[model samples]
Target chain A: MHKSLRSTLWILIATLGATAISIIAISRGESINALWFIIAALCVYSIAYRFYAAWIAATVLAVDSTRATPAERFDNGRDFVPTHKWIVFGHHFAAIAGPGPLVGPTLAAQFGYLPGTLWILFGAVLGGCVQDMVTLFLSTRRDAKSLGQMARDELGAIGGTAALIATFSIMIILIAVLGLVVVNAMKHSPWATFTVSATIPIAMLVGIYMRYLRPGQVLEASALGVVLLLMSVVGGRYIDEHDNLRLLFDHEGLTLAWSIMAYGFAAAILPVWLLLAPRDYLSTYMKIGTITLLAVAIILLQPNIKMPAITQFIDGSGPIFGGKLFPFVFITIACGAISGFHSLIASGTTPKLLSNERDICMIGYGGMLLESFVAIMAMIAATVLEPGVYFAINSSAGAVGSNALDAVTKISAWGYPVTVEQMENLAKQMGETTLFARTGGAPSLAVGMASIFGKAFGDGLLAIWYHFAIMFEAIFILTTLDAGTRVGRFMLQDMLGNIWPKMGETSWTPSVILTSSIVVAGWGYFLYIGVIDPNGGVNILWPLFGIANQMLAAIALCVATGILVKSNKLKHAWITAAPLTWLAIITTTAAWQKIASPDIKIGFFSAATDLADKLASGTLPAAKAAIAPQLIFNLQLDAWLTLTFVILLWIIILDMLRVCWRCVTGKPILPLTESAYKPSSLLDDWVRD
Target chain B: MIIKLKTLWKIIRQLSGDDAYEVYLKNFAKHHCNHNNTDCSTPLSKADFFKRWQDEKWQGIKRCC
Candidate 1:
């Protein structure tokens, strides 16, 4: 058989085999036995990676075999990042696939493992992978233009501008929400907080060393940083034991918010060489190593997926966030399964690094598949926990089916029964005051992971194991935050410069600082809100973030569809167009529901109106009344967000129409560039031979 | 906003009556400006102004006005 055919067959066998096994296993009333399901998933994923991904990496990506990458092609000692493809792949994967896959899947698991798992598989294969691959291909063909530019070139100026605006807005919401997750995880855990806090100086030192002492020695510097970070994790436990240090670590939410803002500002202002670069390197290493360990651990442990395939919480009354499975599943598993953010990465960085046209399959399609697996593992981790504990950990006090007794009663009613004593005992084990409404999925996942790892590594290492999990989660999230900030700043400066040209100059220090502050402030405001919300902030913010992120994917897919149509590949365009259409429908409907629905429990706009009614009625008690106005304001804020997404979607649709018209009329599209491959003479020679 | 609208209407009527839109815009500034002093007149003729307004100037005016 031909190489391509063989590779394709291998992929189909692996993927279809896994699908068949999962279906059979679940159908056989063995929903708890996840071992076969996991093995099937891994085997299929491995085959996909080795053959399908390799095909994409070689043929579909179409990386330039002749010229070295920008890092090699134009080695200006800055920004032309040239690293080995595998290493770069690892870096990209680490950067893009962070706590998102973990948190999203865990939260979505409330609907049952099946809904989340199916979404991860179907969404990645049809939607996420296509978005990443096409964006990468387009950007590579256009000298690695950013997603915003691709939108403009293919869609039009309106589309491009809207994409940029949407991207900037999404970044703020994303970082802020992720920050809230961290804050929640560390809220009362002095040891975890202190340990994560110490990573800053360590990142800085590594940055300084890399820049001034051993330039280009990223591997060595990162290795050293990792060792130091691990030591800090160990040391943090000691500090938490000390009374004075514990007090410092136990800073209030307000204090933590301010600290995070300060940190974001400082990190933004600092040179890339100091904090961002080194942290990215370490994060890259930790992200890859830890996820691999988690995957291996899950398979070896063969833990049962105790959670059912579907739950009664499909209504917008889920414990983690109030939303049904249909829209919420797509929203919760945003990045792990499909993320708009990945489009930016595909267009911004990965495209320029393509070594051959074929590399697209691996970098674009395969990278996303890997992220989906991470989401799968996250589902496993969250579901494997005792059902009552899962509910106790995720449910906020406001939505915990009312009060503690009610909460326990309701959770116990759901397949996993538990008593108040059990909840308290588990909380004690995890070293927290209350596990209820601790809605950052990471800590619960950590607790779940620790349960498994503790059994395997022995119970004595539980605390260390717990902290290790914290560090892993922090590294993934923090890298995203820092990198996201930098990208946001650049985008802000770009927009500012368009309005007033001088602000665009990278060297204009004051302007740069001002723009950076504005960008940081945008996301910072959301983070502050999340930190302050009495209910777990993820409930509101994650869905909003998910909407924004998916909207970006919609935009990207529209652009790709346009290009494919222009190339007279309409039949093939559905590969991207179908998913694009689905996302557009999903996002548009969800956004409308969020804005129009009158239920305070679901509709952001309606919630605001309800809050106002409460404030007007004078029914709010004196102590709680002060927060009423803020709640009202947040609801209105959410309405505006929904409106923004609606507008962005229309812009992309208009752009797509324009591109389609141009293609029909044979008008030259903007940003038109030549393909990288010239039907290589070497291939011809090989054919002849 | 009113002035621009009136000017646009006048130009449209004149063009529909005789000259084309572009030609009317070209000749309007030279013949029909309130100042009638060539030096005081802006370089943008009626047609040029309409085009510019449609693309860029109108958005600014609409935003502010």
Candidate 2:
């Protein structure tokens, strides 16, 4: 009784503190400090982890610490190791932490910081963390089934196929959007282009060292790679100082787009030991190191949030991306909050490494909490910039204007005053030709990161810091681009193998090249149009990516809820059902809006129609007219894609609901047997460091 | 203090997969001794181990966006 009372008191205190900080964050103060965002997020995460997640593990799932997991049962000593919880946590976090959280929050900051901040907190605690933890628990219970297998077993064929197709489509859209981000960051900027290009040779050298020079020496090769990467950052400045070398490295969007597509194709077909493995190591290390550095710098520096609590863009005229703050903010910041993609990681290799079933709460729920915190830091970084400058960097030329002065005038007229001189000085400070209309969130994030690092460390190396940030983001984004392409190739081959056995052989050169090109071309077409789109392709692609990602989350939740209802624990089914319901509402509404909204800025079909009319009437300029037909086709294609996603989403949700109804009404359903799950365990013995 | 730092480094190596081959060898030998079995087949070489590890690791949906 005494222990229970004390725990209750602790929970009460945590709740009260979190509420106060959140209120302060929500209220419009003169200028809120960035530290408040950090504090609020920490308070909410701890409270959720302690009370909510622990309850779910104990009561909802009754996770048995003594129950031997697949890792312990199988004991392969290779892929299935019964690892400690902290090690598992690190691996899981690294797997899920990508450009999604950083770029999503930065783009959503256009609606001001509050909407994104609240969603990142609320969405992760109630939705994202729950989905990850439950999916991890379910997968662990079933000898570590992948998500598609779980869906197929629990919900039937329609749900399984929908889940698989959603995962594949989102992978394509995710890579195309991320590729656009890298292109925008590297285009027309000699320093950034030089630094990013240096990573290829750097990765290849590390690959050769790992493969032949000193086999199994990952740590040493990665350390050497880090040194070379930093040297290239410094060397980029040298190249930038030399006009001819700078010109050679500098290229426009079209050139970078083709280069990235070719790189993806090469990575997909090349042996994993050569390029992908070495690149993954370097990116994982850099991602962890840079995120840690950013967190510490933000704490030490404590920059003030310069944007308002809510901006006029809340009503839907945001410069960065279109659509109202209602469904769009939720869509724009998908990963940092309740990303559907985390479900994939939760159900993937992470589950197969679990030693104790009870560790699922920490490795899954707690891991997602940390990822959400990274999103909070990204939000702080973006909002800490001057609002006018943020708009100037992220807005498209089609939205703002063709030149720096006009962009500044237009942004200033919206009540956030900026000048051409200020932007020019910032560009020079960052070693760039221009900063206006970078438009894909990478350049602005680099600037924000540079400013923070410059203030916290020293102001002397702002230009180098800027390029370092760019290089880091590009490295993370490019690794995802290639790894995703390779995975998509395997997925396509698997699907096609069902039809033609010859096509299924992953080692055949003909099969490899065919699938690799098809996968590359799948995303490359989107990347190509995104490169040439004058209205800023991210404006369309990011939302589509968000919708598709959320659809996957919905499918994962359906499977979890179906299992809950089938296990006769219908009372606890709301834990997954609530998030599934919310995702369904958001994805369905967002898809409908993208398809049918009358506003040309928000809807794909409307944009296509608007452009087609302009083309017919000869109102478009010669340059716009030349690209008008392709843009129209692309927009209509996006609309059709969104419609398909909506249909697939409903089919999965309704099918799962049908399965649950059958179980509820005593009808026969797919039986989950005791051989798949057994209960035994105590939790106290497993917390050792 | 030195021991503690060593332990921390070991943990980092474990998590980053820097020490994967070492762990695999230890586990392989231990499993060979399990159940009084006397198979005594050679474990994979360092080069082959790394190659197989990469092939298996990338075969599934590993990374996220």
Task: Put down candidate 1 lDDT per residue, A492-514, tens digits, no spaces.
Answer: 77778889999888669998789
Q: Which candidate is the best by lDDT?
A: 2
When summed lDDT is taken over every stretch of 10 residues in candidate 2 chain A, the lowest stretch is A679-688
Model 2 C-alpha lDDT per residue in residues A1-689, reported as the tens digit of each score: 69999898777768766775766566675777788788788878888898899999999999887687877766666788778888999999999999999999999999888889999999999999999999998888877888998898888888889989999999999999999999999899888888888999899999999889988788899999999999999999999999799889889899999999999999999888788888888899889999999999999999999988888998778877889988999999999788888888888588778888878999999999999999999998899999999999999998998888888999999999999999999999999989999988888888999999999999999999999999999998999999999999998888989999999998888989999999899899999999999878999999999999999898899999999999999999999999888898888888888999998989899999999999999999999999999999999999999999999999988898899899999999989732455444323433245
lDDT of 1 at A10: 76
In terms of DockQ, the best-performing candidate is: 2
- Candidate 2 regions exceeding 4 Å error are A1-16, A19-26, A677-689, B33-39
Tell me the whole-model lDDT of each prediction, alpha carbons only.
0.71, 0.89
Give model 1's TM-score for chain A to 2 decimal places: 0.91
**Second chain alone, TM-score for each candidate:** 0.27, 0.77
Counting only residues 3 or more apart in sequence or on different chains, how many pairs clash (N, Cα, C under 3 Å) in candidate 1? 18
* TM agreement with the true structure for every prediction: 0.84, 0.97
Name the docking class for model 1. incorrect
